[model samples]
Target chain A: MSLHHQIRQYLLDQAQMHGWLAHAKIPSERELQTKFHASRITIRDGLTKLESQGFIYRVNRKGWFISPPRLLWDPCHRVNFYQQARDQGMQPETEVVSVNPLYDAPLIRHQFGMDYGNNLELLRLRRLDGRPVMVERIYLRQTDFPGLAQQPLDGSITELFANKYQVQINHESSHILVCGTQSEEAALLGIPEGTACLHIERKRYDANDRLVDYNLEYWRQDALELKVSSRK
Target chain B: MSLHHQIRQYLLDQAQMHGWLAHAKIPSERELQTKFHASRITIRDGLTKLESQGFIYRVNRKGWFISPPRLLWDPCHRVNFYQQARDQGMQPETEVVSVNPLYDAPLIRHQFGMDYGNNLELLRLRRLDGRPVMVERIYLRQTDFPGLAQQPLDGSITELFANKYQVQINHESSHILVCGTQSEEAALLGIPEGTACLHIERKRYDANDRLVDYNLEYWRQDALELKVSSRK
Candidate 1:
């Protein structure tokens, strides 16, 4: 292996073992170049590869810092984000931000097949590990919950659907896209304005194949990734 | 329904029917306000909601544009980009750009258990419709196909594996993540620098569970979306 590669691996292993990826800082390119007797280009190349592979991130003109490994999600299966995190041995928690009843607008009414003036409850929260990664705002039919917003605001939304409402979430279809963060989203995600984000709009259908909830999740681009596979 | 919402639906319908997504300009905020006969605040609210929901993208100086839809993919099943596009009723094509034989690096060699100096043939291409959308580079064991680089590289990679190498791709694993386009990537995908992309690295295994091929695919973000379901 090349000296530059050797140094890169050494830094990666140290960071991984330290368990301080979210804030661990590594040596500067000049420092690495001097220590390894390598060219600046070689050091930069090693760092570039590591950054592209989701190992670390750069802030401004400052040197690199170890970034937390992204959560890998299998897109082919019907798994939600919280469960996927737990399955990968990470703690999943949701903080309820607010809940309110909203009246149906024409566009939302059309999408949800609700009549005019039909009231729906909107539940908003930030889902996180020990730290926040994504913000979720869910809109559900009020008739299905029958005062769900008044209940406890913690715990899994899926469990709330099953145990409290007796609704089985059989399947859901999600649409994922990328966009620059907006002011509201940026404030919630704690990222800068115009930082890229993975936006997911999901309409979940119940066992009877009825659209039960419309949920939106905005994921921090540097922190999470979704993976999917298909049969050849 | 509120007048503002009625206007929102009208704009969305126009966007959908005309495919007026990202890069395609829309009526100005002032024009929308005049046409909808709604207050500027109301129009701004609707536009803000659309932008927040990923249905539109806004520029600092420029106004909003309809957001492009992403290609939804299921990762658990083995499916290719071509198939995913076809399922969405869109035309898809793959162009073979280059093929060559090269030495396998230590990482590559260890991953595939290959010997040093063993030549590995790689086929590189850009998958496109009327324009390039994804770049796929596939590497194979040279001994499996002595003349693969010289053969006419068309059709599916799986078919090539089956017909020439007599290998059945029975199973595979894939890793997906986000990537920012590099210079070479930009030249191939015909996109500007800093374009967000989906990076998928996959290794296919044969029926005997032996690794046969390793592929790296960079998909244009505007062209694809992924969906995963969560079972509660």
Candidate 2:
């Protein structure tokens, strides 16, 4: 094995023994360099390997830390983001950035099968374990859920639809892609602009086969690797 | 819209009308700067936007080019790569790198439900329109397909299995991820190492519901953004 590989294995073994938690800082670069008797470049190469494999992540000017395990998301499942994170042992928080009535959105209009009417637009920021993980822009037909603005918005929209409106979502479809983080999303997610993100365009249908909502979500790619399948 | 946005739109509109093919180089940076009457940085920002959206890809020394459209791959689908690409209006080619018999592979051994026996390992490169798109390392049970080494391996292995070996695949499951390119894979895919890649691990089962094969595949993230759906 190369020196770099040895350095990677050393850090990994130590991390395992340390029972490393998410965002737990690792040793400094100089520390690794002195301990391994290797150059800074060699230590960085080893750290790069760990980052690529999703074992650890580097925060600019902060240091390297243990990465949170990926949250398994199933579009077909009824579970929402808050519930999913809770099930995975992460504290999930939702910050409702904005919700307003919009009369003109071409794509959402087409998806909702609307000819003329208004839709509610929602910009939400979601965090897991105090780290910003995703931002979602959701669109829903305003008339479908009247008085939606009266409901508490900083929570799972899925649960809101289910319990408050008695609207059950029976079908969903997701289109996943790799996308660059634009400036606004960059600020909200605390990542640099143009970072790769796991972009998911999801649509939900009611039991009557009516389109209930559609959302474009961008998830931070540093730690999450969503393994999606067609069935259980 | 920003000047960069205008430049990106200009190039995109032109590509659509021109029927841009994969690897078709766009205008040089200088040319774009002159045409847009913008600074080189502005021109590059536009190009970066296009690249991030999977509309174009860059070569190390060569300029940017229109990226090939992403292939829609379904693990639940019975179609193979060669067939799927062909059906999607692409000239697909497969190169069999090597096939070696291995006695010890812990992961493959577990996937195959085997306590004892050797596995045949295959390394293959697949291309779309002469561009290296994916490289797969496959592992199969040696006893499952006797005389597999003698079979013609350059084309579709699925065809070979059905016709020559009388083995038909009925099921497959895939685990997808985002990974960074390593040095060796970078050379094969003709991209810089540490480039983000879409990685997939797939397992195949025969009609008898026995695990027949397992493979790890790395896809260049330049142009392709696979949209996976879980249903028919």
Candidate 3:
């Protein structure tokens, strides 16, 4: 085996044995180089390998740190963002980016089985513990919920719908794909372009089986873990 | 907006209106350039933008083609490999890369509540319609199903377990994350290193609520779409 590979294995063993907590800083490259008696390039290669494998991440010049524990989410549960984060012992915050009336959006019209009028679009940026993790774009049919555009758009939409509109979300159909983040999303999340992300498209329905909202969520890849329990 | 952006929008409109089927070849670069009276660089830039958005892909010397329709998969469904592929109108094939007895797998032993000495590892490469889609690594306890390592490793392990040991999987717990593909998995899937992929870790249990197997699956990003239905 190569020197870097051997060094990587050693670091991995150390991480496992010491129970290196999330966000803990690993040894500096210089320290690792001196300890292994290896060249700078070898040490860098080893660290890069570890980073790509999800063991560590670099924060510009801040050096390498153990990756944070991913937020465990169960999409099947009707829990809102606030409850989900609180359940995992993390602070959650939401910033409403923009809210505008949309007209003549063919896709949104088709999804809600309406034609060309009275739609509201809401864009929000969500963070966990002050780290931006997801960007959400939601479209709602205005005719179904009069004056929805006037309501405060921050915080949990699910709770807002239930409290004000008395519309309980009964079902959700979601599709998930992995892709490179676009420039706009990258800028919002403070990540580089082409960073891998999970793109989720969902159609939410009310208790009457009406398509109430269509949502698109772009999530940072390393920050979340989607959990599902299957029954046979 | 830039000229390339305008051109990309026009092409997108065309794709949606004309029902451009998946895997169909789009107009060549020369054709696009001539039609738009644009330079080679401008046309290439627009095409590259589309490719990165998952609208199309390049096949080396074969030019660009529309990306194939992603296979819609519901992980909660108790469907085997063969049934899942056929349900999506595709052929499925599996090759057993290797199988061996594992004695000192600390994690596996801990999960199965065993000390050591009786574990089996199986590695498989799976394809849909002749295109590599996923690589799976499964670890099973030998004491639970004696002679498991000696059984035929090809085809569906779900069926094999039923017929050989009468062990029906009753529940599965899964965790999903998105990350850049590793070198070994990239090579097997015929994709470039560091390509985005969905990594799923699953724990399978039998009717008695005993842990039976642990599996890790790496799936190509563009080849599959995970679907989930949440009921409230």
Candidate 4:
């Protein structure tokens, strides 16, 4: 095998072995060059191959780090996303990036049952164990919650709905696909612009069959593992 | 906006309007340069951005073509994938690429109820509307199906098992993730190696609750739209 191929395999084996893995940074290109006596280009080629394969990611100045196992998601789980992560022994965090109001939004207006085409959007940045995982934009009508803007934003919206407003999620429909990150999302996720991402679009309904929520979530491609029962 | 951005938006508007799109080849870089009086780099930058955003794709010898909408997939659908695609007004095609035998595969042994670890693997390439969409690898134990090698390979395995073998899929568990395509899968799907893809791992059960089938499907990221209800 070529030197670059050898380097790729060696790094893969290092990652597969728990001893050398973790979100830990691998050797720098200079370090690898000195250790392996290979050209800088060769080392770079190996690292680029690894990055494209989703085994590692580079943070602008921080160099490269081993990617963690994707967070497993089961659509049948009855809890919210954060709780689900916690159940898997992961520390999940959610921050309210921004909250704004939308009026006369034509495309999304029909998705809701409200007579008026007015809605509130909550932008959230979420992390798993300190690594940026997802950025979610949640949309809902302001008329549904008169004082929603006054409520705390950093907490779980699901829990807040149940405890504060006597609301619960009955059922929801979702669409998942692969897409590229735009500038805003790229900045939040710490990935490059146009990086491949897992895009999820969801709509939640209440007992009365009212469209209670609509959400768009963009996740780092390596951070999501989706498990579904069936959808023809 | 810069000339390249203008070129990108023009192509996007053309595709979204559905007037000039239909998988038809867009102008070549040289043609685009003449038409827009822009540098070759400018034309390429626009096309590159569109490709990265999943708006278009290129064949090896052919030029760029607009990408179609993702095929919708629902995990709760009662029918098989091909049937579902048919219902959506798409011409689905399946081809048997290869089949092989395996022995002493320890990793997969316990996933089946069979006492022995010997199994057979069926490799298939599936297309939608003449576009290669997925490459599937199916694994099963030979002891479960006598004379399985003689069975027709191109048709639906789900249908074949039901009609010829009296085996029906009762329930299945599946995992989905965003991954990079390997060389074999990339070759079959006509995509570059390390391209982002949607990876699905599924295990199907029979009426008797035995693991009857194990399948791994690699799909072009732009070709799949997955819908799941909940797993949290």
Candidate 5:
């Protein structure tokens, strides 16, 4: 491998081990040249390649910094979270936070397709790897999944849909993008108020056109990445 | 039409005539009952429906305000600006801000697929729905369209691609979300500094795996809405 590629890999390994994903200003070109024992041109070549790949960026006078790649989600596909992570070569993990019945709220009323007075249920959590990157609040229709709160939901909700409910989520449409974390959201994602987060408000329905699940996934901007390979 | 629909349309028409998107708060339930000569429940129901559909969102102590739906561009599809606007039932218009050839900047060099020494031509603009919504800075590879700088690029670049270079951009990937308007971006978007704006970064390519266009579209947050329908 080339010297620049070697240095790039070394830095990437360090980042992976330390679990740092946000942009970081590293040593200047002169310092990198002396430390990596490479020419300035080679260092620039490596930095430029990393920037193009959405791994790092130069901020005017501030030398170079690591950057998380943008995450590309195809609204056309209804793939689950774990599947989406695996496709991107990431280790997908989950932990249960809370599962409780929702009572007399607008959110629950809408999720359960219940009458104005009917009840609903919710599962909220701080989903993460080594660090919490997202807070997922899922509202499930109680009529469709009775006793779901009593079952083990720490694993895959997709698997639950298939094996337990015998339902197949063939398609889903998501409204996905970024937003400044609100006070409540910030606390859950373990970030400062006004930190950037990728918010995915998704509606998962069954084959019969019933609203089965609604999810709000707040992903930490620093810890996630996505790419798009468009079809012609 | 129902009284609520009449009121909604009245608000919308007023918004259009004033050439702005936001509106004064609606009369309180008591006031609405008197003005519309309807029950408070009816007025509340109408407001609730609109809020659910994202036509409006609450602002804590402040009452309801008209919300323009955001434009959700699917990165998987090769949809152009005009098509995106048309889908939202809005008339999209553009004014050419400036078109010039540039070179030497690393960012420009990377975007236009230019050699370190090559020149790139840019077409800048403030786009609108009969009123300004965004300012776009578009960079083109001069190698692909040698005489592009001399053409009338005031119209859609997609048309220019077809006519000048015989290239049809079949797919585009975009990063679309809210961002605080930087000083320079604010000046271009005609908004105050720190105002929220939608920053859309896109890379367009043709059918043969060749990068053809690059665009940065910065839109005022209050100026647009995004809607996506997904089936599960």
Candidate 6:
């Protein structure tokens, strides 16, 4: 094996033996170069190989760190994001990117069984333990929940719909697809363009069997573990 | 946009407007070169871009073809592979790669509540409409179903277990992860190395709720659409 490959193997062994926790910063490139008696480029090549293999990740302007274990997601449950992350012992946060009245969104209209100009579009960024994991765009019929746009948009929208509007989401139908990430999604997730992502579209209905929300979520592939159980 | 990008956009427009069906062969490189009045290199580059975007794929000795629409899979149903594909209007076939008695498979033993040297391993390749889509490795307890290795093993193993052993799979717990495809997986699926694929691990239980099988499936990302419905 080449020297850099040998160095990569050594570092990988260290990671395994030291129980390097997720997101824990590894030794700097200079430190690795010094220890391995290699040049900067050789050390960099090794790290790059590791990153591409999902063993590590680099944050811009920050040092390299171990990639975190994926978050387990149970789609069959109605638990909101906050509760789900907390249950898994991870800190979760949501930021409202934007909310506006959607016009002429044909797909959303068709999903909600509504005409154009009747839905409010909400875009939010969701993070787990301070790492961006998903970007969600939700469209809801404006008449379904009055004054919804004026309310605080952070935290669980599901809880808000249930508590304030007394509209419980009774059912959800989700479609999951794997596709290349768009530039906008890559920007939001801080990943390169053309990275693979899980694109999930969900149609949510209330107790009356009326479509209340249409949601589109793009998740970082490395950040989630989806779980489902089926019984007959 | 660059010349190749413009060509890519033009081809994409044709794909959208012409109603090019899935798996339908697009024009050849020579034809594209003549039609677009572009250099051969530019045309090749454009096609390469489209392939990487999952808009198209190349079959060795055959020309480039449009990717098929994703197969919608609902895990709630206990339908076997053949039945599921047939229900979706696609032909499904399975090839048994190999089957052997497993020894010292700690994970399989733990999952099946068995000691070491008690499991049988079956490797199978699944194809949809004559195209390779998934590779499955199933580990089952040898004591649970004797003489399974000597069976035909071409069709559904679930059916075999039901007919011969009267073992009905009652429940399935699945874990879904998205990661770069391994070398062996890429070769089986006939895709480039490191392509994104959905890795699903399922633990199946019999009617008495005993763990009967542990299955690992690697699905080509572009060929599947997973669906789930949640109810309160």
lDDT of each: 0.67, 0.76, 0.77, 0.80, 0.62, 0.79
Q: Which residue pairs clash within candidate 6? A: none
Tens digits of per-residue lDDT for model 2, A80-155: 7778788889899999888989877787788877444798999999988988888999999888789998889998
In angstroms, the error of model 3 at B151 is 3.8
Give residue B62's lDDT in candidate 2 (0 to 100).
Answer: 77
Model 6 spans > 4 angstroms off:
A1-11, A17-20, A24-53, A58-65, A114-117, B1-10, B14-21, B24-53, B58-65, B115-117
Give per-residue CA lDDT, model 3, range A68-186, as digits (tens): 76788988875788888988898899999888888767877788783446788888999887777888899987776788768888878888888998888889999888766777787
Per-residue lDDT for A93-181 in model 4, tens only? 98889898987677777777546656888999999989988999999888877789899988788788888888888888889987778
Using TM-score, give the best candidate's number. Answer: 4
Q: Tens-digit lDDT track for model 6 on A1-232?
A: 6554576577678878998788888899999989989898778766654554466766655788888887888878757788888888999999898888877778678776644447899999999889888999999988877899899899788889988989888888898877666767777878756555778888888777888888999987778889888854
Candidate number with the higher DockQ (2 or 5): 2
- DockQ for all models: 0.26, 0.33, 0.42, 0.53, 0.14, 0.49
Instruction: List model 5 lDDT by residue over B89-127, tens digit each.
Output: 777777776776674567867765534445464646555
DockQ-derived CAPRI band for the predicted complex in model 5 = incorrect
**Pick by TM-score: 2 or 4, better one:** 4
Q: What would the TM-scores of all predictions be?
A: 0.67, 0.81, 0.77, 0.88, 0.61, 0.85
Summing lDDT over every window of 10 consecutive residues in candidate 5 chain A, give the lowest-scoring window: A114-123
| Least well predicted 10-residue stretch by lDDT in candidate 4 chain A | A44-53
- Sort by DockQ, top down from the best: 4, 6, 3, 2, 1, 5
Q: Candidate 6 docking category?
A: medium
On the 0 to 100 scale, the lDDT of residue A180 in model 4 is 76
TM-score, chain B only, every model? 0.67, 0.80, 0.76, 0.85, 0.62, 0.82
In model 2, pairs of residues that clash are A230-B230
Q: Write the per-residue lDDT of candidate 1 for residues A1-232, one digit (tens) a residue.
A: 6443486578867766876556478888899889888888778756654554456655546667777667776544756667778887777777777777776356556667743345564545454455456777787767778878777767677777888878887777777766656666666656545455677788888778788888777776666776655454
Residue A128's C-alpha lDDT in candidate 2? 88
